[model samples]
Target chain A: MTTQTTAQAPARVRLTQLTRGQTARLDSADFKDDSAAHLTAMGLRPSCQLRVCKAGQPCIVHVDGHAGGCRIALSRDLAASLYVLPH
Target chain B: MPPVTLPTNPVSVTVAIRTAALVGNPNVGKSTLFNTLAGLRQKTANFPGTTQEAHLAQVQSPAGPIVLADLPGAYGLSLNTNESRICKGVLTGDQSIKGFPGGKPDAVAIVVDATNVPRNLRLAGEVIALGLPTIVVVTMTDAAARKGIKIDAEKFEAALGCPVVFASGKTGKGVADVLPALARAKVAAGPLSAAHIDEWADAVYAKACTAETRDHDAVTDRLDLAFTHPILGVATFAAIMTGLFWAIFSLATIPMDAIEAGFGWLAGLVSNTLPAGAIRDLLADGVIAGVGGTLVFLPQIVLLFFLIALLEQTGYLARAAFVIDRLLKPFGLPGHAFVPLLSGHACAIPAIMSARAIPDFRQRVATILAIPFMSCSARIPVYVLLTQILFPESTMLQAVAFTGCYVLGAAAGLFTAIIARRTILKGKSPAMALELPRYQWPSLLGATKTAAARGWLFVRKAGTVILAISVILWWLSAYPKPADPDDAQRAAEVSFLGRIGGAVQPVFAPMGADRQLTVGILASFAAREVFVSTMAVQIAGTDDAEGEGVRERLTEATRDDGTKVFTPATSWAMLVFFVLAIQCLPTLVVTAKEAGGWKWAALQAGWMTGVAYVAATIVYGVASAIG
Candidate 1:
């Protein structure tokens, strides 16, 4: 199932590859209840640009423009689930 | 019909003040705070159908009596996983799991870690939006201070328009003042204010917090360099795991030997004291020999739990999870599944229960099914016996082979998960959105306490369920004795159980398991250690020469053809088979209940058994061919 990449593609791709210091914009709808709810609760939305601040095995992404920039660690599976486009 | 005029009486009624549920992300020191308020006066019961316990305690407040329920530490009140669902249900009064059927808490104590204020506040903000009377308890203030971080607690409280408590659970500093304050606080019960947390992010920070410095970036950089390095991170994870396994094997031996010696002594004492009778035979053979045989390995199991608990408490487990997550992603499992899968190495019951962390139903089920494939501690005695018999000449090689069996079990679990995901459990792999709490030194006292408590529970279970089953098995093998006392050995060969074993012999013949082995297999279904005792009993009954002990009886036993029965190849195959098989009834029962019914459990057992049979058959066939 090939799908179009959103502006968050870079961030999502970096997450999938476990590459750090990359940024991307993710489509909110690409997320399921579990992922979406967690992301939304963590303040990561469709238009919000997130930076892959720390990506190793368990990657940490920094959601920019938030109070003191929220940092979240994304497991490889979660990184793959997110559809992102280059920001 | 006209209603008669009633006297207008203003009757005063006392309404019970509803509870305030404390919920938050993991490692926020919420549990410590909960324990402080609840003290030893708390009731610990499993959340319905789940192994996770719901701790309930009632505290008398000046306002009224208030119930304090400490829900599981969860990121959000969203039904992504089983734990989260339980948390959500408890928060919203969903009544999905009826253990907390008294409706939702009147208020919510959103515990936040002051050290990581941003991430913690995110969860706190979400809880506040749930329309519950929210009290934000900023825990770990001491830890934050140690890290050179400071926050204005009262300012944060005013910003959120909720009572905020700066409490240190470790020292009980500032903790005594929280409950009294909560009791006196007015119920701001109304629909939750529509606080768009994202929009007010900067405003909230400016109003609530004051950072001392930008020095955290340097620490973060160093951590990122070490932990997030592709090569270094993987190597560190491998080293950690190797150490874990090595510790499990080496540390367990001393205690395991002690337990075995104690049981052997008890067995000898019982046999010497009691006159030849059914009760003596039952006590010596069934209780002391059978149940005691199983208890001998309890130390190893407890040690394994101790190490795991230490790792978990120290926050190394989350790092391990992250490492495994990266590796397992290609295999269609989320990283969150790693802990559960790792837990499976010790036992599948807890592992299966721990699958509550996996959000997607398909992923969770896959993890659960795969758990039994991990070489659980229950299989250790069987494996040890077989391995000893097989590699009698080489202890080092035997140890290596034992380790190999564990690796093989893990491989099998992974293989099965892949197949199940592609076939029966087909679905998109769930996303793993997890919070990695900062690394902390593990509390030795806490780890010891947890390990002791868990070990005691296990001993209690063995005493009851395992003891009963062993007695029943003894009866099954002992009764309907052969007619001739002079030819007792031949009589046993013709008795009811002997006949049954003989009948089933052909089925396992290909696997090099004869009638005696068949009987051992039957006894193992009750408890795996019974395999050892059953063999001991069989050897004792067949030998005419007076043997001083069970070990000597076993060592001296010969097949009908005058050859040693415990051959290297046969023993190794048996060990391999037991290590892979799902034979424990209690495990099956737990699996059945966890899976929501008996049918799924049956299917799981059937598949595992089939796999064990085929694998054992192949091992035996190849070994015999090579020999």
Candidate 2:
């Protein structure tokens, strides 16, 4: 789940599939409009790089690029909604 | 009539003192800045029709006295939330909103966290779109610098078309510059378009903000790793809550005893100084005793709030909430419910108020509904009395039973929450999305100030209601005095409360509660602890005996049929009843206010009483069958 793409583009996986300490780029989120908007407000916008600090029912992530490297914690359902490509 | 016109204000009327509002995303050090600026000259009031509160204070600036309104933090003013509504209302000068000092604030202070500039800018952009005089305060610049991020103040100000100041609320650096910056605050020539605000903010960040590709605090990462671990995090929460309650109990005892003794002395003085009459009794027992009883809980309330504020300031409470979210989500409650649910052990009035922190309306109501079942400290005396009767000789069994009461009560609360969520309060449980702010040293002064404010609020709101109920209860129990006046038992038999108890006795007869026990139960509706004193008064004619003597007398009391009242079955039933009952009047009043309706309170009382009755009846029947 934390595999690196050696010679090809990174394969997109659900955020929950990433292990702790793995870095991934957010692809897109599959949430209702309000939930998706809230996620974006909290700095989880598509194309931002997220480093998983703790991944599980509630995952702790350090987001960079779109956000100013702020840490956010997302519930399991929310994490599952997020599609990320691991680096 | 055609010539009638209003006179213009005199030139001396002075341009009405400008009003400004502070807006920001949560956990952006906005509160610290407000506290630093406003100091002790602030008042907190709820926005009209909502439990959400805003702080307003007068801040003296070179421009003049600027009235500062601190709006609740919101991620987006357009979001469908109480906080966002209030924020937008105040900014738009909604006359319906009561917290704003002026119709519309003359200026806005948009607070952004330097460490999280882009996300903070999202909110800032939303605020700037209002086209009001605005200033962007970049807080925690020190924290950002520590994380290897830099912000060019001039570039940021140029990009946003407003004044920008870098300030650290903790170290007090650049804080002084904020007041002066407010004087030069300017409105944007044009508002940022809502549709392209994201691109605008991102472009601004790309130009004015720089990062050295640094890890966002390795220490914080390690802390989060352990704090958010499923197993370790839960254990940590358990240990912390256990310690919190233990500290509240142990630390509050000294002050509580002092308050009780002081009130007792005052009551004794009043009784000795006054002539024998209803006035003397009222003063000695009704007003003074009522106020004293309510104030005696101040220490616990203060300590609880103080410690919670400290934990919140240190940024640990969010992690705690994250850890507890999964455990509670299944029951239709959110992680934010943890504080209120846990605080219920100390007292339910404050716990109910704390539920304001819960963002979801359904979850907040569900949490409030379940809080009363947490076995508040008021129920401890009843628990002790019943456990003693159930196992008189074995101290160990009594201890086990006492602990079981708490566990059983918690179980009842959680199950009740689940049932309520599934049926009445059904809605989508929003997925948790809490920001884990960087760990910082907690401010003792800030925590103390918060605790003091909340403690006073409790006294002002709950105190008046509790005192009124106490006086009413006292009047009910003391009236219709017999001709002998000194004949306590005869007076009780003729009193309105006693008569009602006698009538209700038949209803409780199946559970083995006689007229005397029924009277105690009726009186305890005012407070759970009143049961012990009512029984002592009804049986022994003195409600002041030490624990052992009182228990001994109650254990041997006989029913009208000469059967023992404190038999195993009866004692067990009483224990179950006390555990599940909603027996606090002050709690109901508070619940009504905090939950925004009396119907919720009515539902709470009705449901809890029904559950207690049915559960107690079952226990009585089962225990008697076994015997």
Candidate 3:
């Protein structure tokens, strides 16, 4: 169930730009292969809503029950790979 | 994700459940449950030829005693790492698995975190979909209750078409119900399609759980703000690590001394009771010294692992990992490398094994290569001796120099890893994405089990590989029979081992090592601490060594022309040498097993020796200039 905000369609920015406590839906990420598959497997995929738990080099993001109520920590490079769109 | 299929009928169920494999992701209280069920009937075993280990224990159930195999924690069936690969293989009976009583598990139990049902079920659904005779046990009911979460196990079981039991490892709530539930489960005829696994888990959660629509955990929120803060987190991690190392060093001294004294008493008794022959000498020196040398480090290793396990259970480790990611990534390692690197101070063997925590293979290898250079407790005796030889009368100088040795060792290890990443074995650093599990009270039994498992591995290694090496070295020096016991010193000089040492002496002369010091280096291949005892025999004219008074004997001993052998230059060079050298044979053995092969182990030893030699030469050159 992929949802598209027509007005914000081209506004996919990196997750690194997300502010702390701000929730956004992960549209897609530049990552592919194992990196891409890993995010999907961890349930951070298109239309998955995640909140920024902590920001910086190693960032912690919250997928509060929408994906699995888990907090995932991603290195800055990995987080930057994930493109997100604000709600 | 790769989906694995289990055997349609792996075990024949009877009046008693013969075998069951307990599998789950990390932080699911899998070990706690296993410990509660197994009590004291547990033992650790290496999974056959693989470096992976498992805890096997037989627990009495209402039906009968069923042997439970506690597999390593994993996130999914996809084989990204050894831990996950091993779990999938064990559950599916695809590999020739070792350490289990039965060739394959007769039944399987998937532990689902009751508090985090949706996420836990992501794996639970996959396991249930494997068609193995399976039962789902919901744990952390107490923790979930505190969060105002409720799970209806019966409804959850109805949704999954399997048996579900709510159990709390913390309070021993509903633990006895697990075996009976497992006895009733059988491999389903038709497993669910993988495509709808999440939907199935969602459906199960919808039917079986309820919670207040809370935005976040206030406790976790506050803790995270402090623990994940850039400046505060680093300070806290440093403080915690210092406390841990301090505990390991200070607390382990009592047991270390006790072990040393006991081994000394045994050696003395052997010499007193047995006839003075090769047998007596073999038993005393070869068997006792070799095994005893390896075992002496056991207390430090056990304490190191115990503290690590305790910290890991509290969930602070995840935050620490996050905090240290900045430091580790630069060296081509993940943040999780900090624990193993810190633990390397106590001993490198367990630290190498614990490197498995860093999910990436290349990073894990890099961490293993760099670990031995981290000034392990085995190296401390060497550092102290060399530091003393360099600064005999100045205790303050000795302390400062000893601290400098540790700092130098760490810097050298980190740089070595950077070089390793740049040169051979060059590859992309693994992606970093880890779950930060909620902080909880550390499990005491789990910590004990972890310490005991590692401690047992040390003892076993000593029993097999180390014992043989110790005995072999004993024979080499003992034979070529010294013409007279009184001329033992002169006779040893021309003996087989002596010739080997003398042959290598000139090669190492630039670093200022004399023939006797070269022999000490060769002897130390058995263990780093053996350097002291070897020097005592070769130079001090006694077998007793260590901080007690070997400094005087070592500094006073001289060579031809009455030139002082332990000049400040040589002593400084020696300190740098031991700081970088791979002197412990047992460490290489563990490295071989953990790093996947002997080639990596050899590379580690060879590379470290090369580095040690070059660095020691420079130290010698500089010190001689000052002299």
Candidate 4:
């Protein structure tokens, strides 16, 4: 999933670097234990497109995918763990 | 991914009565649908060994009477959370979990949110792979329509190899189809492997659902901007909390006063009808007064729950949690602790039970330990008496003192949480990852049902214990009656309770409390509000004679040496004491059960009493020095 989207992007940066309203594709996520699996189950898989709604500690993001989009709020620590490629 | 075990007998028709479990993610309208389907036949129950609560209801289906288990919502059946564990256990027929109607449910009803179908589909797939007779109930159809999302149930049903039913719990639409669907439920075709479940869900969702160019919800975005703003959010929370509490206190007064007056009248009737003796006294004071004291708070409890349900239904509660998370993180509490702590202001029994919402055990224990320190409604009568005594001439000072009591209690609770987290329960707070459900108008009927259930639960769970303790205290005080029964003070002096108070008088001597004050303090352990009536009996020989008369007599009452009993220092000490003391027995029992150990309850009681004793002594010393 990551190769399909990241192959087309010129640059990748941490999710925290994305500003409000910026769209990006999730490249990968680094979480301890089952946190990564839990995030994936909530529809934040690699290659899933997301748009930053509120960019800060406890940031809000809209995860858009083929199935439809849902809004989620992530704490600062969680937001810092995700790597995303700007669309 | 964890290995998913598919149940062998998904369509087991061997059981005499069939059972089905309602499974879904949190905020998917599952609860609402359950309540609608099983109206008045449901009861909230705790899953064995865990603090998680689920509702079980029996509904009559076209095929037979089916018992519906409303399992706690989870993100997936394989997650580490208690919700997921319980869901998995029940679905897989884990017989070790007792108290469930059926050891393992015969079927599973997977509720999927229409608006957020993609996110909900993974859980649905997991349930389907269990090979259980399953039906996908697509809820929030009305909300989905408003969002310009359409779900083709035929395509979804065909794609998943199960019947798909669209329902809107809010509008009572498609609810009638649930039972019928459950009757005709069938296990889906070959199970999807654990690794491929997510892929299968996404593919199914794509084929069956279409969205009309979804745009950002402008109203929600604007509301979130103000609600989640740092300074603005805090101010809004404060204002909203103030309004909530103010409404509870003010609106509940009428019903509270009525309950009190009704019981007072009952006590009077008991006294007048019975021949004046131990029976009359027991009926009037021990039974009527004892039970009524606890029942009077029912209005406050009901009102608090009703208001909270409304707030939660509006989806603002998630934003509130997000905002409060910032403040509570430093104290080592997760944002989820907000509701339980807020509920503690009304009563600690329910508040402690509500702590099950905290997923982490250590965090839940910390929250439960800190809850009793909040100034519960039980302490109001004591506060009213003490603040008035402290500021006899000025209402402004009394009001300030009253507010200070709440502030002091809240500060003590928070500080205790901080200290506990740093010392015994040491861990960094877990980062919150919450899905903010879309906002909607709250259901008044649902709020009413919740308030009714909570209010009744309080009475049912705590009522007997309170009555039993009050009766015991009455026996201790009424026994060994003096020769002159007419003299209430002399009888009290000779009774077991009075002698016990004399024995404990020295312990409180440093706080300027005499035998009479000591007796009042000891009696208040039954319930804080009992202090007023106990003082009336101890000092004035009758509790029925209420008002300024009793207050004046108590204020002017003298010790054996003719010194005033209620000294300035003693009033201040007692005020601080009530604010910090763990006086309610039901709260301790609940803490023990909910925290899963007597040691935690002992720790909570010991720590709180120690704090109260030391704080009260210090207050006494300072007041004496100032005077």
Candidate 5:
């Protein structure tokens, strides 16, 4: 199920729903403290486009172009906490 | 107090030295920058409130030679871990927390990954708001250029209100410019609130760097697919670990043997030079041999660190951690424990020290506690002694038995950690977000420096503690000597250790250990390999075999009842006990320091001892029945 505030404003989808090879834009993350601060610091911010290189509870992501971009691993807990809009 | 206060001189204040701190996210080339700046002149010490050690160095700049403190990599001001919080305190100049010489940095070099502009800019914005003199060091420009992304430093600086330098540690490109930028660093006012900080970073990045482009990288994608394929990832991780150990064993054996021989020759010289007295014995047996025994494992430690540095440099470590995290998380051990756990095969001291990199408190402790059970290189000799006793001439049997010890030790480590995580060090396993740095050539000089530091700290910090315990053990075994002696065993029987061994013999009788074996076990508490030397003295008169090795004569050594000492059940039981036991006092000392206090150390020692005894007893019962 996908929820959208409006067509132009990005549809809301759980980050876990995005599989490997799928690119998505991060809308918001539902975290408060360490996890939130950590994710934000790692560049999983709203409006930032990221592609899933590998998907699982702990997903691997490459921001921007897959070649020269920063590749980071996120834990399942972090994955579930994120809200994304897939492209 | 009032009467004594009159003589107090004016408080002498030491002039504060200007210092810069290197701060950034992990795998963002922060360390490379630090190493490039500091070279081999770096010092590491634990920051207050956490086990994470801070690296400080003195690097020359045009402005002056400023002290550089490489603070732990962190995202923003505050985080859950004590490490990140300590970093926050350092940046905020919280006088209550100790980090730098002046309680805060004069300037901070924010090493940003150039490819991740927005994210790096986000951190840059937050730091700029702190009002510290800061410079944005854009690293990996060479790699960034390959993807058609160009970083305009002037535009970035103009927008962010600070200096920005496009540098690559790999190529040493624009590093000189960084020092000057750092010299002229000044905190530019940032957005007032967190919400606006994002907007500010987005706006600045838009003007400063090329727009984001999304496309598949065939090489990286193929590598990722191969490395992270669920089943293949596990297999790859295991294969890599096997390769690591194989390299450690094969590459380190030559140096290990040389160290052993060198120490033996030194001990021989000391023994011959001095008269046959307590002084000679103390110098040769107590001091040289005791210290040399622990130092013998240094080669393995250095090699392990060197290889781990290579793995981290290649970016495969992050993937390895991710793949293993799936297996570890269910056990309540986080993925990051892999480095410490893997390194434990070399030695536990370095393993415990490296556990500081783990961000989560309970997870780090769990890894620390579990490390000693990883069957380090020190336990190899003891394994050989027991295995040889059981399967005298069969090389295949000995090899098989050796492999079993490793498997059993790993199983024990995992089992104990799982139980501890669930029961004592109870906390939800925090999600770990590890950055996969771009694969590049591992820096040999940097790795060597790191290995040297770890080895130096091992000897300098834990060495004295081990030497002290060795001296005490030596004294206990040497004291209350009879006026004359015919055989070493007879001499030992009349000694203080002999009496103590007799007193404790009944406790170990179920494991088929005689009093002398009990004494060996007691001495082994200092270190595992010491058991072989001690057993040689108590079982046979000559502790040092020289030309004729102990291996040939050990099979013929017997107990007092004329019963053959190397019984199958007893050898296997002792082997099992040695496999599981916490025999290294130095490991305990390090754990005490690393795990915060002696409380956790005491628990670890007591529990491991208790478990080893029970497991050994069971092995003895079953083996005796089968035999």
Candidate 6:
């Protein structure tokens, strides 16, 4: 077997850019002082992952493993205010 | 800072405590909880600037006298929707808007459904964030237990740093504890720290929520499959509506007949006992006939309310909204507007008030404007008379045509709503965020009590306003009697009101209504049902010995040119016009009160009258052409 080399990670982008069905690994403190307070109250936190279920108009995001993953509906304006790191 | 000590009173002093505001999401048993706390002392009044009324009551608690205001249920304080904004302003002491005209509450009793803790907690978190003293009253605990959902109240209270009371409004269990807890509580001066809420939400969910081993996915999937299916859902909605209207018509006929018979018998008894003078004529023609005609509709109104209440309680109303939302979108109305529009068919007053459920300003206005277009039950008497005159030989066809009048009215309402929304009431359609409450077997007692209370209120209003108008109409047609029995017909034609109708008759000649019908239409402006009574009085005044009833006299009415006045074309056009017209003064007054001023009501009335004039003109033109 040929030896494999590790690749460098891409730069972090805004949380709102995450596409539908994509999961994000976020830092809880990144959301602490930001507009992410709403997201955190909805069970999205640092070290927690969220899957984007829908990405248009009123975006629907699913929080992983909390109460069988609750669906959070956010207006486009509110969704654009979030920031998250890609997994 | 110094620690101050207060002097003790010589005698025992009891300070009266103020009332608490009950706040919660829609359908979380807040109303039931308010009923428990207030009991029979409850009073409801309309909220300022909005038609939605908040219920208030005084509670005599052991601590002191506390009053409770049942604020309209809302989802979140952050949302800008009308209902949510009202709740937010009340809770946050931001009363710039006049929708809620009271001061902020001393404390809030936050109601939550224990069965749906996750969704309920979201609302609780928002309320707690307001920094007011709050007690979480977890309702539906009994339902939750049956559904295998367990909530640890202690854990929840510890997490939120507030008291949590487990209560069931249905069973009245643990409800007494809420007021006492609220009586002794002090409100926090500032909002909960954002850091604290984050920690609290995470800890509470982690500790209180247990992993579900059973799969509910299948159940939800099947429900979605059926409920959201376009073909089946629309079919089911149509079938249900058809059945409801059919039952309203069929079931109400028995009581209506009984009421009519009772009134006729009373009229006969009074006529035989008293002399044939003004008093006898007033009692028989004015009071009995007028009041009886209005009261005869009570059974139908009550039956309609009963079905609506049952549908609301069983949560089927949401599905209706879901279906109608798609259908009504093109009409420039939201889906939830369906309830208000449907309620308008019974009465525009309640229908206008119900428009508060719509969040967007434009949508609400559109709904309000369209409500008067619905063929309210007030128009039924006029339609029946016109149909009888037009289709005397075909009763079944007339009945069908009467129903078609209702359909035509609804179409006119939808068309107007669309035009208004596109021009004057233009705005983006608000997002649909309605929660689908779980279906339950509707309570028979609850439905009956609601229907009875509403029906009685309608009768009370009729007694006050309609009774006064009927007596006035009778008085107007009674005076200036013919000088002689030989010249009676000529004198009637020369009477002041008869001259008025005759002057107006030329204006309505194109529509084929003679002076008698013209007078009826003019009288209906004061009260819609007066059309029937006005015609009766006019017919009775003209003929001396015929002794024929108003219905028979109307059948023999003819125009000045000796042609039948009640032709199918003219009668149908008149029926259609009444169905489309905004003719009730009381409805206009109520609309003014609900809409915050006379300007909006005037605009609505003027536009609706114009629409009626144009539509009636078209109908008359086409029908005359065809005939």
First chain of candidate 4, TM-score: 0.86
Over B1-627, each residue of candidate 6 has an lDDT whose tens digit, in order, gives: 112111121121123347567888778888878876776677666566665567778787677777677888875566555567777877787643232235677778889776556555666767777767777788887656655566676666655556678776667899888887775453322224544433444455555555443213434334433554567767877787778777777888899999999998998999999997889978987788768867887787788778878888886766566566777888889877887787787767666755766767788888888998898877887887888778778999889989899899899899889889889888667544344566677877667866776687668767877677767766665556676634544544665667778888887777667887787787777567767666665654543222336676777767667777677777877887798888886677666766667887898888887887777778888998898
lDDT of 1 by residue, A2-56 (tens): 3564565443343465356666765534544456776765556556666676755
How big is the positional error of residue B3 in model 1, measured in Å on the Cα after superposition? 54
Query: Candidate 3, which segments miss by more than 4 Å at Cα?
Result: A1-3, A8-13, A43-46, A66-68, A85-87, B1-17, B48-50, B60-65, B101-104, B189-192, B391-401, B544-550, B560-564, B567-569, B617-627
> Which docking band does candidate 6 fall into?
incorrect
What value does the lDDT take at residue A72 in candidate 1?
65
* lDDT digits (tens) for residues B1-627 of candidate 4: 223333233342333337888999988999999999989889887777777777888899888888788888898988867788889988898733344565678778899988788778888888888878888899978777877788887778877777788886777899999888887677875246888776677677766788886656667767777888888988998899889888877899999999999998999899888999889988887888888877887898888889988998998888888888877887888887887898798888778877876878778999999999999988888898888778889999999999999999999999999999989899665667888777788999999999999888888854677788878999998988999988999988989999999999999887778898889888887577778788888888887535887888877778868988778898999999999988787788889889987888899988987899899999999999998
* Per-residue lDDT of model 5, residues B44-142, tens digit only: 866765566788887788777888888777776655657567667777777232434766778888888877777776667777778788778888776
Query: Which TM-score value belongs to model 1?
Result: 0.79
The weakest ten consecutive residues by lDDT in model 2 chain A span: A1-10
Per-residue lDDT tens digits for candidate 6, residues A1-87, read 112223664344555687766767553233223345334434455555566655543444555534444445454555665555567
Docking class of 3: acceptable
Candidate 5 residue pairs that clash: A57-A76
Q: Please list the Cα RMSD from the true structure of every candidate, rounded to 1 decimal place.
A: 7.5, 6.3, 4.0, 3.4, 7.4, 7.4
Ranking by lDDT: 2, 4, 3, 5, 6, 1
Better of 2 and 5 by DockQ: 2
Worst lDDT window (10 residues) for model 3 chain B?
Answer: B1-10
Residue A7 lDDT (model 6): 64
Worst 10 residues of 6 chain B by lDDT: B1-10
Ranking by DockQ: 4, 2, 5, 3, 1, 6
How many Å off is the CA of B482 in candidate 1?
4.5
Q: Can you tell me which runs of candidate 4 are displaced by over 4 Å?
A: A1-8, B1-17, B95-99, B146-148, B189-191, B353-357, B391-400, B544-546, B561-563, B621-627
> What fraction of the genuine interface contacts, i.e. the true contacts, does candidate 5 reproduce?
0.62
